[model samples]
Target: MKATNKTEAQRIAYFGMKKMEKEGGYAFTEGTVSNWFNVVKEQDGTTYGVLLLEKRGVCNCPFWEENSEFGACKHIYWIREELAKEADFQSLTETDPRWLHGGGI
Candidate 1:
């Protein structure tokens, strides 16, 4: 299924999170670059790169390549949530363009 809007992408991300929890999929930042992350699928050792841009995220994963114009993929969603927990991002509101669109990264 293709995600056609932010809401649909969020729904997709929700299911992706459930699968990740079940399969031990995980993601971590690369070096000191807060905007760069490597998402790994533990079950297969597969890795995809996710780059947070000023207004959107780009992931090398096929799903993201196909659906990114509409909204974020699971890796993007996960990283955004992780970043939100960091001190640097704590002051931003959910609706802030920098927060919602990955601008301040």
Candidate 2:
């Protein structure tokens, strides 16, 4: 979903992206389902699952659970941006049996 205002979630996402670029503690993995993704932050080594729905995206991160009304959390935003850059975005969304089990990269 589109965010109308500049919310905290967006700021977090921005910083997260910058951190990923500057440091080396982020990992993202595509899920078996086209809309599913796994996001990992190095600070905590926690894997947050991001699920893209028809109209909105969801994340298992605590920040998202509490502030989802405002917009997607860092994990969701990160995965969405990555997916958008893919040349085969449509095909990537298709079900892939190889990703049936979750793994990080």
Give the per-residue lDDT of model 1 (tens digit) for 1-101.
Answer: 57778788778976885666566657665745767888777667888888888878888877787787765777777776667657556787888888986
> Residue by residue across 1-105, what tens digits does model 2's lDDT show?
344455656887678666666776777888899878888776898898989887678888787777778656767766766676554434443255433423212
The alpha-carbon lDDT assigned to residue 8 of candidate 1 equals 85
Compared with the true structure, the alpha-carbon lDDT of candidate 2 equals 0.70
Model 1 residue pairs with clashes:
none
lDDT scores of the candidates, listed in order: 0.74, 0.70
Candidate closest to the true structure, highest TM-score: 1
Positional deviation of residue 55's Cα in model 1 after best superposition, in angstroms: 3.6
Q: Give me the candidate number with maximum lDDT.
A: 1
Candidate 1, residue 59: CA error in Å?
0.8
